[model samples]
Target: MLIEVRNIFFSYLPRTPFQVRALEGVSLTITQGESIGIVGRTGCGKSTLVQHFNGLLIPEEGQVLVEGVDTRVKGEALKAIRRKVGLVFQYPEDQFFEENVFQEIAFAPKNMGVEGKELEERVRWAMEMVGLDFATLRDKSPFELSGGQMRRVAIASILSMQPEVLVLDEPTAGLDPQGKRLILGKLRKLREEHALTLVIVSHSMEDLAQIVDRIVIMDRGKIAFDGPIRVAFSQGDFVKQFGIFPPVVSQVASLLRSRGFEINPGVLTPAELAEEIRVKILEKKEREHAGSKRGNWSVRPS
Candidate 1:
């Protein structure tokens, strides 16, 4: 396993009145090259769970291991695990501090002791990974770029480490349709070209549908559903019980099914739903045409 979480439990503000349980008996295994989506309603522990992947949050009870090394390790060992699992927070652009795009992206790798031409190459490659033009944006200040561009820069900063797994929380949040598309498209390409493992935490089922193959639904600080994306969203009622709206496409498919249309509720994408509707309509037309022919009256008596 690339990452293993063995019956972990965690809480905030431990031993205090404000303490709140965030994760409970959470066990999961992530394989290399797997793309998984972690989702739930607010306060369901999605973010808390991923934080353990990179050794950022050591479990209070159980253990979290990345590449078989426990997260409880400190110093160089923990730092190495972090370099292997890069996490991009929601609104990551808000964390930017460097004066220039290149500096912002180079910071992490530089702190790791990379320098000279090697550092430059890592920065350039990371920029290209996120669809940013290194030649044009390298010298520009991150604050001066558009929201989408700044977000890309933030992601590049992590990518510069060349991590094996990229975990993102609400990667497409607060962006227009075009911006969301740009970020998601780049992610899809990154996964394909580099075989990068992606673990995305998002409330947007539609966005998750476009990227992840598997879906893990969290509820009340526990795993509620874990299965293929189509299977997880197949039952609209079941998914809604956990306070998640099925993907818009899945909802539409369910609506059509209720109205006597033979559409699959497991449909995840708009394109898939459209094709299902088209096939159903064509089948209906064929049946009607055949029925009309059978009902025709013969003129042989004349």
Candidate 2:
């Protein structure tokens, strides 16, 4: 397992008047090279849970284990663990102090003792990974770029460190369609090229449906569903009970099925739904043709 979150119970402001339980006995296991999506409503502990994967928030009761080592360790050990798990928050802050893009991207690795050609090479590699040209963007202030570009630079800062597992919280939040695609597309390519394990927390099932293999639905500080995306979306009504709507395609498929069509229940994409609907249409045509032939058999020569 790449990460194991074992029966963790965590709360905010413990022993204080504002105490709130963020996670209660939450447990999840992520294997290497697996793409997983965690979805839930606002304040449902989705972000809190993922923070534990990188030692950002230690569980008050149980523990989080990354690569078989405890995340509760401090100093050099914790830093080493964090290097393996790179986390990008929902809305990454704008880089202000860095003179330019190269410095911003190099900040982390440089602190880790990377310098000169190696540091420059890492910065360039990270920029290219996010589809940014180092030569053009290196000297530009991140604040001067568009919102999407700034977000990409923030992601590049994390990528420059070359973590084994990538954790993103609402990666597509607050973006237009094009911006969301730009980011998600880069992530898809990175997963293919580097075989990086990804743990994505988002409310967009439509987007997650396209890339993630598994879905983990959280509710009220606990996991409500943990299974393959197909299985989880197949039971549309069941998931709906927990306030989760299936992907748009799945909802359409379910409606068609209710109306006597044979659309697959777990259809996750428009293409898949269209293909199944076409098959159903062909079957209907075949049945009508057979009925016509049967009627003619009972009629005269005409």
Give the Å shift of residue 278 in candidate 2. Answer: 2.3
Q: Which ten residues in a row have the lowest lDDT in candidate 1?
A: 293-302
Residue 240 of model 1, lDDT score: 90
lDDT of 1: 0.93
Per-candidate RMSD, Å: 3.2, 2.7
Off by over 4 Å in 1: 286-302
How well is each residue in 1-25 modelled by candidate 1, as lDDT tens digits?
Answer: 9999999999999999999999999
Once superposed on the true structure, which residue ranges of model 2 sit more than 4 Å away at CA? Answer: 94-96, 286-302
Q: Per-residue CA lDDT of candidate 2, range 29-69, in tens?
A: 99999999998888989999999999999999998999899
Once model 2 is optimally superposed onto the true structure by TM-score, how far is the C-alpha of residue 37 displaced, in angstroms? 1.0
Specify the highest-lDDT model's number.
1
All candidates: TM-score? 0.93, 0.93
Steric overlap count per candidate: 0, 0
